[model samples]
Target: MAQEQAGRVLRSVKWRADLTAGVLATWPADPRKRTSQEWEQVRTAIPGGEGLPSSVIKGRTRQAVTFLNANGRLPVDVFELEGAPRVPRMLLLAACDRQQATIERGDTDPGRVMLRLQLPTRVDPHAYGDWTWVACPISLPPMVPVSAVLHLPTLRVTGRQVRADVAYTHTVPKAKRTGHTVAVGVDWGLNTLLSAGALRLQADGRITALGAGGQFRAAGVLAKQHRLRRLSERLHAKADHYQRLTAGDQQHDLAGKHAVLSDEIQHVSARRANLNDALAWAAARWAVDQAIAAAATVIYVEDLGSMEAKGMGRSLNTRLSQQVRGKIVDRMRHLAAEVGVAVVTVPCTRPERGRVHFPVRRCEPTTSDRPHL
Candidate 1:
């Protein structure tokens, strides 16, 4: 039932985005800087625009405009979505009420703490009253603090499950920018996902390493990532070849094979994304745990956003480009924020320079500590 309702919302969002794209294609000026109200007025130009919620329409218009800004045009009509569409928060609230039901058995019992959400059955993003209320038991590996406040959740359908991503807010001590005696320096590497160690800022103006730093090695996971990447490349090559052979002729003999290949490519891409997400969380958790154990006040990470992979061989360059450094850094910041541990990204020098650009002066080699998988 949840899956069916989710499908309806997904279709609605896609339809609205496509409609907005059609309008923007003929637009003389750039549509990226338009305000929400300006975009809202465009609904009249689209047929059957009264069915969708204003919020959903606004959200999709922003997305369409972003795509246009990035790629200079809309995607091809045959483009398949990489993942499930996100249901706007307003629609979630309109479909259900009293979502903040507390557990009767108190906070200690995890089983009793469940999130009650209503999925709309009438396939209307704006209309209410035809909701299918479901009481989904909440479970997390980590315990939720009692003082935290729960906010509305965004729902998405993945495979056969309806995943609700819930977020909470709590107060934590603010991280300090200066007056630090001990800190951790995190460096990015190709083989070693991260190399982190603790350093002490001495009173006499000299810096010393506390101990041999540890490395986060995901050799097994990286191997699987590369394997999937190679498979994806092969699938894409074959799919492109099939497309060329068909020449946009849907009735061509190779059209069926091309469609199958496209579906397979999407499946493989989703698997790779899920793997990267899990790996990022694991790496971030390990980095935070290291800082906590070392009692470091701040974590200084290397900013390699502009780092180029051209110097290396073709294979090595491809592997480097596929690294999930951005995701890892984002997760690190999110986890560190909860504990008031500051994560700072410093400028990084080219790898050929034979030295990393550390935020602190004169550094020692990373620790010889055991690597964390």
Candidate 2:
């Protein structure tokens, strides 16, 4: 009970921090086979002692480094310098790591984790971009730790190789749950489906089905794809047969069949594309609409592993659509933000795929219907 209570309090506090701390690595990416002896001098020269934070120096050795601080914010475009730009950057690790270092008082962490002052997001372009081994920013969000990940790893923020100065600021979470606000759950359909219902906890908790796409459009799209697939296959088969017939008799027949197959492929591809665009648009819009209707700040979604619906091995289209769900979340987040709403993903615990467990109470009505997608 104590541990569970602590976990809840810790999450509440940690989520409120302003930024993240993670790895800022710089490898000699464009090496033209630079030699061993040269590499030694390069490596040693990388960690300059002059006016550098000791924590930054220490980060140079760890697999995942932090930005404690750098000597100067150098320009990023000067990477072509003969003996500059290799300065191993120092990063401020936002939380506890394997290092077991001394903890700082205010740094975000599980235990007493020690680190440097915060790093800034913007670097002066004129001041940045020099030094043989200067540590630079990797143009990516710092790594964040999530506790409930399984199956595929929780989607992590990655490093972008293009930027030079490193700065990570975690947006503080507002812990004050809006008493009047309600939440809504979103379920995405496979091959164009939609299910949405708002879960209102304000006043009294209520589950209201807010949106549904009638089966008519969904059935039509599915049937069209099936018919197109068959048409393309038959045309292809007819072409093969014609090509095996007498050469003099085959020319016109083969040409017509191939043309027909090409057209069918194009037609099917267009239909699928339209269906996907519509489904995504609907999902995002309804989620946002429900949030607006309930006057809520937070929206909850399935912590879908790899953003995929539960099923057999995924095909290319399925994979492509799975990726599209991420974009939907992104857009929904943006729209929600426009209206002062926050979007969150709660994990679908294995034994309980659709139910949300509360610390003080649980609601069975939250999972009144099975997943439709």
The prediction achieving the highest lDDT against the true structure is 1
Q: Give TM-scores for every candidate, taking all chains together and pairing residue i with residue i.
A: 0.67, 0.35
lDDT of 1 by residue, 300-341 (tens): 888664465556899998999898887888788877776777
lDDT tens digits by residue: candidate 2, 1-373 = 2344456556644422111111122333223333555444344554332333323323332311111223233222212111232322223232334232222222353222223222234553343232122222121222321221111111123233321222222333242233434556665555544454565453455544435412212556555545655565675677566566635463565666656656766676666667656655655776778767766556666654334232555454533333356656765664554455666665544455654432112211111111111
* RMSD in Å for all candidates: 11.2, 22.9
Q: State the TM-score for model 1.
A: 0.67
Instruction: Report the error of model 1 at residue 298, Å.
Output: 0.3
Which parts of model 2 have CA positions greater than 4 angstroms off?
Answer: 1-181, 189-192, 200-253, 305-331, 350-373
Best by TM-score: 1
